[model samples]
Target: MTTLADIAETQRLAMLSLSQRMADFETHLKASPPGADLTGLHKDFSAFKEHVWGVFSALQRQIAELSRSVDVIEMRHRKKFLLLGGVPESSGEKVPETVASILQSKFGLSDLAPSSLTVCHRLGSASDGHARPILLRCADSKIRDLIWRTKTKLKGSSYVVSEFLTRQRQTAFTTARKLFGVTNVWTMDGVVNVKLPDGKRRRVFSVDEVVALGVEHGKQLDQEAPPESSSNRKSATSPPSIRSRRTIKKK
Candidate 1:
C-alpha cells in the first residue's frame, strides 16, 4: 500500500538530484577564468540547464498525477459517509439514535434507520462552543447521496450536511468559499468547485489550487496580520545616558 509519505520522498529525491546538478553547474562556471570567453562552455551550460529543467518538470508532473490518483481513491472510500453539523447536543445521549432521529424529524428522512448506519458518532468533544458534528456512515451509498442532495431542506434550521472531505480538500473548500463567496463555491463528490466571475467553473483539490483560483479571479487572498494588543505594552524608554565625568582641573 502506497502512502503519501512515499510520494513525498520520491519528489524530495528528485529535488535533491536537481540541486546536485545545479551545484555542479555552478562549480563549472566558477572554474572558468574571468577573461576566458568560452562559447562552447556557454552552450554546454545552456543545454545543461534546459535538460535539468525538463527532467525536474517531468518528475513534478508525475508526482502531481500520482497524488491526484491517491486522493481520488481515498475520497471514494468516504462516499458512504456524511457529516451532520449544528445538531444540538445532549447529556448521555445515544449518538446513532440521535442522528437517526435528526435525519427523520429535521431532514425529513423518515425512513432512515439507526441500523442502516455502519458507524455514527460525534466527531469531536462537546467542550467546544459549537455543536459537535455527527459523522454518519450509511450502509448504502445511495442513501448518502439522497441525504446530500436534500441538504438544501436544512436551510434556516441549525443543520448542515456535507461530504467527508480529506483535510487538503476541506481546506481548499473553505478557502474557495472565502475567496469566491459561498454562493459561487460548492462541493460535489469531494471535489471543491468554484464558479468564477466569468461564469466558468473551476475545481480545486488543495489550498494552493484555491489560491491560484483567487489569483485568476483577481481576489486579494493575502491575509493581513491582526493588530497587536496595546493593553500590556510598556513605553519604550531610551537607555540611560552615561555622563562622562570630566576631572575638574584646578588652575
Candidate 2:
C-alpha cells in the first residue's frame, strides 16, 4: 500500500510544514520587538557592582582593624620580652643558664633573681644549623625596661639585645632605620626613635608615624636657615654712617 509516489508526497508535506513553522516563529519574534532597555540594564548593573564593591571595601577595612587590634593585644602580652641575637647555639644547651651568664658577665646585672627569668629559648625555624635569636621573658616590667635601655651597651660585643616588638612595629623600625640611618634610629618597648638634627629624639609608634617623621627629617635636611633675612643681611653689609657728635646751630 506504500508506494514511491506516496513517500515523495509525504516528504514534501513535512518540509512545507517545517517552513511554515519557522515563518510563524520569525513573525512572532518580530512582533515582540525585544524592547529590553540595554542602557538602563547596564546602569543598573553598574550600580549593583558599585554597591558590592562598597561592601567589599568595608569588609577590608574591618579586617585591617581586626589585624591592628590583635597586634596591639599581642604586643601588650609580649611587653616583657627581649630578643638576644648573635649568641652561639649548641646542642643540649641550657637557655636560662646561658642568658643568665651573659646578663651577669656582659651587663653586670649580678643581682637579678633567678625567678625573674620567666622564659628563655631560641627562636626561628632554621634548618641550616645556624644560631637563632633568643627570646627571653622577664617577670618584672622594670627589669625588662632596664634591659631594653642597657641593650645599647652590647653594640661592640658579639651579642646584641633588642626589645621584642610586634611585627608591624619591627617593620616600622626598619623603615625608620633605613630613612634615618642606623645611628639615628632605635626602638624601645615597641616605640621607634629617630634622632633629629637638633640632637633630640622623637618617638614614633606606627608606620604612618615613621613616614611622617621621615618627611619631617627630609624637610629639616632640605631646609636652609631662612636665607639670613634680607633686612639683616643689608644692615650687616652696609657701613655705619659717621655721625657728628656736635649739632650745627640753625640760622
Clashing pairs in model 1?
Answer: none
Model 2 alpha-carbon drift over 4 Å, by segment: 1-37, 113-115, 126-129, 194-251
Deviation from truth (RMSD, Å), model 2: 28.4
Best by TM-score: 1
For 196-237, candidate 2 gives per-residue lDDT tens digits of 767888987667777787687574333332344454333222
lDDT of 1 at 24: 88
lDDT of 2: 0.64
TM-score of each: 0.72, 0.61
Q: Which 10-residue window of candidate 2 scores lowest in summed lDDT?
A: 235-244
Output the number of the lDDT-best candidate. Answer: 1
Candidate 1 lDDT trough over 10 residues, lowest sum = 232-241
Deviation (Å) of 107 in candidate 2: 2.3
